[model samples]
Target: MSISITMIIFSVLFLVFIIRLIKTATFTLEYSLMWLAIGTIMLVFSIFPQIPEYFANLFGFETMSNFLLVMAVLFSLLQLIIFTKYTTKQTDDIKSLIQEVSILKEKVKKEE
Candidate 1:
């Protein structure tokens, strides 16, 4: 199969947008790297359409598109798990800070 011009153009546009976002501080490097890597990979694949098919065959996927979808879903789930952990830690820290502040306020009131 041959790569389409539209796909290549879209991938390049996406890569450019991602870099602009990073430069503008809209997304930190760590947060933006995943999308940057994805855009880069898509740009590469758009140039070499056969690479994905080879990977699909090596992985026993019936189609390269299916392999791509599965990988996207897996990555999304992994990100969700990481975000959940980060949120939980933040919540706990907030609770601890609030409790400490209340205790300090109580001590100040007693002294006054």
Candidate 2:
């Protein structure tokens, strides 16, 4: 109904897509599983009448629709932030690992 609501619904769908992508992508098992769980949980919670009702009315067709959209947007943003952080950490780790390997190679060459 409203812009925020539309955004939220779109966002939720986006999160689900991200989860699937993660599963297929080269990310580690733990990371992929974690994202999948997070996406599913968010989707389930949003659909569950009792949960959404606690904070605000979720039964009205237009209202619920709008609310859902907003929720989706918030969830998507949160996931993105988390994903970015994980990527940054992973990148740094790879760099560190590369350095370690280079040092090991040099050490092996010297001892030979």
Candidate 3:
């Protein structure tokens, strides 16, 4: 019924979900690893239950919720950065493939 117990339960469930996704190839190892790490960190925090509060005090946050909100935002920004990198790489790969196919088509035309 306590917050720490609830957190531990949720973390365990999330970890299981991530593992299932990895096993089913729904998520790449890279993505799964991030989720796994997050889950593990949540589990650790649930066990300690006050580390975040300590850090929040150290950082002069008005409240624990404010600290958590800032942490969530930072985590989201990092995830966005990672997805952007992946999208850029995919775009470049598609461009390269298109160019290669076009060159092959040109060679075929010349041969014919």
Which residue runs of candidate 3 sit more than 4 Å off their true CA positions? Answer: none
Tell me the TM-score of each prediction against the true structure.
0.85, 0.54, 0.92
Indicate whether candidate 2 or candidate 3 has the larger lDDT.
Answer: 3
Candidate 2 residue spans exceeding 4 A from truth: 1-54, 57-62
Better of 1 and 3 by TM-score: 3
Off by over 4 Å in 1: 1-3
For model 3 the TM-score comes to 0.92
lDDT of each: 0.92, 0.73, 0.91
lDDT of 2 by residue, 41-61 (tens): 666664564565554563453
Candidates sorted by TM-score, descending order? 3, 1, 2
Residue 3: error of model 2 in Å?
A: 23
Model 3: ten consecutive residues of lowest lDDT: 44-53
Superposed on all Cα atoms, the candidates' RMSDs to the truth, in angstroms, are 2.2, 6.8, 1.1
Reference-based TM-score, model 2: 0.54
